[model samples]
Target: MPRRVLPLTDVQIRNAKPREKTYSLTDGHGLYIEIMPSGSKLWRMKFPQRGRGDNRLSFGAYPVVTLQEAREKRLATQRLLLQGIDPGRYRDDKKRLAAEKGSNTFEKVAREWHGNKVPTWSERTATNTLRRLELDIFPEIGRLPIHEVRHRDLIDALRKIESRGAHEVAHRIMAVCKQIFSYGIQIGLLERNIAADMKDVLKTVRPSHFAAIDTDELPDFLAALRRNESRMLKPTLICLRLMMLIFVRTSELIETPWSEIDLEKGEWVIPWQRMKRGKLTVNPDTTNHHVCLSRQALALLRELHAITGGGTYLFPNQRDHKKPLSNNAILKSLERMGYKGKMTGHGFRALAMTTIKERLGYRHEVIDRQLAHAPPDKLSSAYDRAQYLAERKVMMQAWADYLDSL
Candidate 1:
């Protein structure tokens, strides 16, 4: 017959070293503590497995797990065994469920959604979307299970953006929420997107109108911009001039990279991803076509290059050489030049429309293509590459020369 073991006191266990020590206790329970070569001590409960010979269940480490705590844990496992359950299997199942639950959290789904959509967005757009999520969504429903998110919870979260008087941003946040929820549905994390049904709760507001400079005053404004002396002020003036000359969106100009320009070809190839219309509509041939550069525009780029070319962006932020100039940098310069409320960054688009229509006598199609406006005809639009290379070259030079004459 095997010798029975006895329970050891805390004092006896503490003195026990590098050897297998066993104690047969009074309650038909056997206590065994093992001291490893590293001098670390472990407590184990050795009990009979009804069908099997014998098994050991590790209670815990010594010191960190007190004697009382280890005994309590041992008793709990014993009770489970008495109820015909395997404590080890039960613990493993609980851990597996917890991991699955964590993976289904709203934040996890949102991150996955962001990862999928980021490749389709420009660097700037991706940055802005993540920033918005970090600021707004992450704090509220980020940890909640995706399936449990309600419309009211999403509305309350978006209301924070609305409260800031950023109605447009609120709308954008709603779109982001919808996208994330939709992704959850597609991935089988949620049965349906609650954001899809919450659109009616949001208030509709008119788009804010931009205040543009009167067409007659553009000459004086152009002249003033050319003569401005502030080191920081000149590049923005040139950027504004280019925006007006090409009628491309202000965002395109601000984020312009040096690699996108081809001086020999006299074209600035705006990638489809960077264009206002997303990448799907971009024609490979059209997207790579150059915006014709005039002598004056070329001269301006040369001069600006002398100052900012050492960096990656054409117009880098003064404080951080890595980042492009702030989106409002040009608008702010216009305000400093006393054009506040009279002209905005977007005002340049209107100015170009008016100039091409009233002053230059260009066709609407030519003007719209130069502006990169979406084509009106579906079939012709598919075929139309907006071949404005020759016309734009002439128009840009004339516009620059006109600015010089101002």
Candidate 2:
């Protein structure tokens, strides 16, 4: 038969005095009060492990945890023992879980997610992503645990960003937050993304179109571009003209490196690292993007090459020769040319896309492919990049001729 032990009373515990050394007074059933030499009282419980013998667990200090509470905790520990669980090990697990939760703040998780993601992106993309978090999200609710992020919390953060007139940044930040929360869910750090429900909650902003000139404005635009009295530098004028002849985006144009262009082969390869790929794609992020160089485009490159050919970049920043030209270089140049709200550097691509489709009668598929638009799937994008290289060369020459004629 098991021996029965009596419970302790508060009066008895409070009346207990400290001795020269620590001494324990049993309340029975694994509960006891230890009176220390310093007159402090501590509540402790000696519980049994399945095969690991006895271990001590703390209920807290005396008076703060009354005898009744200590008894209740002792009973709970007994129940755990009866269920074949070790109270000490269980407590250790709880402590570990708490530590993990403490470290799993929204900012920490988002940065971790960002770190894993930026390897597949361009330097500009990686920099912009981190800048968004630092400027927008981190100051608001970054320190909170991932699960503690409410929809209103994210909405409030993004709305603050939107109020500052950074609408596109707000949009991109929300998309990134959704991805981070989804990542937390995938990695077992969160239950459900409260931020997920906010997918459609952001204010629908009308797409901001860049200032692009019409097709008919091109003849005057070209004539103004080539005028001897033009304020632009010789290298910049050639760059502005080449910007129209190629299907490349203005950003890619500004950062064109000498290594990526092969004049001998009449090809310019925009590495996948520079392509506009979102984080969700399963496609190989490093796919080679080919740009068919037209004869006019080649001639312009050759001419510009004589000037900047010795440098690493085709269009080098005059102030910082080692770096690509500032993204605003061409845009500002156009602004000075009385086309501030009329024509943009990127307007050239739209001009080509519109003209090639409407006037030249090229297929949309061919135009989009030449523009390096990622197809819907990995297989299709792969096939598209390599397909119609020959056809693209012919189309590119005709397109260049059309621009020169204007």
Candidate 3:
């Protein structure tokens, strides 16, 4: 039979330890302290492992853990055991579950999304998108399960941005939510996207009218750009002029690599991935299709290359050599040039479209193809792969000549 009240004084334990080597001192309760070889003591509780003979649970080291504290820990475990729970297994299971849940958190998923999507986006696009997520989405629902995010919850979260009178930000948040939820769906974390059905709830505004500077204003704008003092401003202004002359998206402009530009051939070949329609739909034959450069565009590129050709990007950010300039850099330059309300980066597209269609009388098909607009017929899209190289070359040269004339 076990000793019911096996209390022994500290001196008694110290004296008897050399002979027995180990001894237990029990309070009247279930708590007991074991004295060991190195004069170290530990608290332990004796209990039966159901259907097994006997088991012991070590509460903690003694001295650091007083007798009272050991008794409390033992009583808590005993209470759990009495309630038909195995304290050891219960604690282990809780820890395992907590770890699993942590792995599946929104922050973890956002990180995964970043890893998968960053490579596909331009450096600026990836950085700005991540900044938005960190500032807006992560702070609110970043720890919550992606599947558990409801439509109302997402709408309410974006509503906070709406409350700040940022309708554009609200739209951006919705787009990001859609992308994240779609990613979650693809990975099987969610059955259906809650963000998919939220489109109708968010009202769409009519496209705002922006005034594109005409040919008459081009000379003054170019003069302003040339006269700008900032080291970072000139390349961006040249890029803006190139964008107007060539009429490609700012992303396409900023992400242009030197390897893709054939200075001798007078061409710029944007890859299928960087193309506006993405690679899948663009015909394989036209994969390496080239953009014909004007004399002015070529001269600008030559000068720009002399400065930045050492870098991978044609227009690397001033602050970070590894990164391209921000998409807004050109627009911001225009803003500083007192053209904020009158023109924008996108206004270049409108100016080109209007000039090509209304002023120059270029065929709609030619203009559309140059602008990388989608074709109507899938078969023609696959087969009729024309880069409008000859016509675009002439148009670009004439457009540059017009700017020079201005």
Best by TM-score: 2
Per-residue lDDT of candidate 3, residues 171-261 (tens digit): 8878987888888778867778888888776657566666678755766777776666464456776787788788887778887888898
As for TM-score, the candidate ahead, 1 or 2, is 2
TM-score of model number 2: 0.79
Candidate 2 lDDT by residue in tens digits, 1-406: 9767676677888888889999988888778989999989999999776677888999999889888888899999998888888889899998998889878999999999999988677666789898989989999999998878887888999999989888888888988898999999998888887766776766787887777877778788877676633687767877887888885887788788898988788778888766665332455456666787888889989999899999998888989999888767787788777778888877877888898888788888888888777678778876776677777888988998888677
Q: How many pairs in model 2 have backbone atoms within 3 A of each other, for residues 3 or more apart or on separate chains, i.e. clashes? A: 0
Residue runs of model 3 more than 4 Å from their true location after superposition: 1-130, 145-153, 175-204, 207-211, 214-234, 279-286, 377-387
* Weakest ten-residue segment in model 2 by summed lDDT: 277-286
Off by over 4 Å in 2: 1-6, 10-26, 35-39, 49-53, 145-153, 208-210, 223-229, 259-281, 284-296, 360-366, 374-406
Rank by TM-score, highest first.
2, 1, 3
In terms of lDDT, which candidate is stronger, 2 or 3? Answer: 2
Candidate 1, after superposition: displacement of residue 338 in Å? 3.3
Ranking by lDDT: 2, 3, 1
